[model samples]
Target: MSTEPVLPRVRPEIAALPPYRQGRAASADGFKLSSNENPFEPLPGVVEAVRDEVALNRYPDATAGQLRAALAVRYGVTADDVLVGAGSVSLIAAFLQAAAGPGDEVVYAWRSFEAYPSLTLVAGATSVQVPNRPDGRHDLPAMAAAVTDRTRCIVLCTPNNPTGPIITRAEFEEFLAAVPADVLVILDEAYAEFVTDPEAVDGLGQRVFASHPNVVVLRTFSKAYGLAALRIGYAIGDARVLDAARATLIPLSVTAQAEHAALASLARDAEVRIRVAELVERRDRLVAGLRDAGWDVPDSQSNFVWLPTTDPAVATAFEDAGLMVRPFPDGVRISVGEATSIAPLIDVAKSTILR
Candidate 1:
């Protein structure tokens, strides 16, 4: 008989993880507002550039030089400060591999981004999550207090996911002051474009390059850029930190077409701005609607709203209305799409909400 073990050996962390699940599309003609994709079509020039790039029959530039250059100009950073990845999500993985290991601790906000604890666990590290405040914002003071010498990094998601809230500049600066100088701080700004917070913190890259030395910012073209399918994202940080990120990344992860499309997007900034402005209006309107309906909705700064439904029946009611929103134990994250896309979700609230 073969001497192989009956069950396959696996890392306990990996084995323990529930697979990643995003809300599914409802039907052939049903709205796909589950994922936070931009409702607009790609800019004319961006589509043409992507088509032109596909004819090259070659791999993308390993360094993604042209895309990096465009991003640098947009962010007011030098080329050395930017590190492009397959997606902003990929950089999170690279950070885990480069910075954390067994017995090390990773910290982040609970219900901020569902991916945080999963990413930390996959890296053979322990996750230390501080709960979000009543308003769905990250609990900055508590998070800063939890950081210890064993802590490798803390991810600060602003205009935080799931719950659309931001970290105020004052709160963030205080959090930074409390954290050890050596501990890495990753500010994931995946939804930065939609944020209307006048007092928001700009995050790690711009300042760390000058002084703090252990901070990084992750941004993506997936949402406001209407490039979700392209899967391109970049990180900005101190040169040394960016170098470390690049070292651990797989070569040529970005496709040539994606690089071209991203570069094309830089030139279409004005149009994207108009579209983003529309989203902000819609988001604010949705928040007010939900709040008036007696659902405790926070002031949303991202492209979504959090319906804090501590009641188990709330999610089922949403589904009963033929709307597929992400239901968390703490709340439901309702993505904002075109007006028509969310009609079903609105219908549910109108019918079931006794008001």
Candidate 2:
């Protein structure tokens, strides 16, 4: 008999799917801008809250009741309307799993979030990716046209990842009107705290859930709240919709430390706002500097700016200058990190663009 053991059968689609790739880590002396992370240290209160959770022997509150209640009050919703997950990405996965299955279609913008396609695939659903416009904004009309009877869900990422343009309130409203009432709409506002534009859509303020039973707004404490390490995010929508997502969630994924830290962060909301304001100022300055250097940078309402370059060499050049940025097939995304790193970044941009 052959000594080799047979491998278990695997689904072909799952086998073909590429694992999600994360941003590359930086060297000790380098600035890591590949991930759109908050450069500031965690608030003292947040740190203390995490330390206060000492029950290693006990499992965390699986429902995350305290955190959900807190977020419910903030968003003017009942606790039943909120769903907490390990992160916004996890909530997205749960939503996809809950709503989509084999032969169903999930529509979203291409070159938006890298995880969208994979999430759909994992849910045994088809992805209908509408191409982004020349300005890196979602072509909402095209997306609406793409939806069909097979479509189960639509993901709208504003201040879109990798490309920083936002969907205007008017645009989203019109798109929502065009979409069928039964189809689930996920409004991913991960970077909303950095937005300074008056015209941009605020999903929370818009009361999308109240207006449309199908709409769900996803937000994260990872970016602006500096809780990426803790991995806590929440969704606001109808109780029935959230209940479905809750069914698909990993048991006890949201830790007590994360929930307490999020609560602490909320308590010091004014201080958090100040940190966000500083980052926004830095982002604006960085965009201005790049534009002055003759780069055709987009007007980013997020914490990062996009460089519409297809050149692979640009990323290498940045790495050579001890700055790690995210390089995609269509563009490079450079986050506004430390103030000390800005001079080097600008110098590199000037040299590369001039070349």
RMSD, each candidate, Å? 2.2, 1.2
Clashes of 1: 0
TM-score of each: 0.94, 0.98
Q: Give all candidates' CA lDDT scores.
A: 0.83, 0.92
Candidate 1 lDDT, 1-355, residue by residue in tens:
9997799889876888899897766665555556787778997789998887676778779999998887788778899989999889999889877899899999999887888888888888999989999988899889988998899999999998988889887887788889998888898999989987788877643354456678898889999998989899999888898887788888989988888999999898899899999988888877777767677788788998888776667767776555666778877778898777555666676655663
Which 10 successive residues of model 2 have the least lDDT summed?
A: 48-57
Tens digits of per-residue lDDT, candidate 2, 138-241, equal 99999999999999999999999878989999999999999999999999999999988888989898787898989999999999998899999999999999
Which residue pairs in candidate 1 have backbone atoms (N, alpha carbon, C) closer than 3 angstroms, thus clashing? none
- Positional deviation of residue 351's Cα in model 2 after best superposition, in angstroms: 1.6
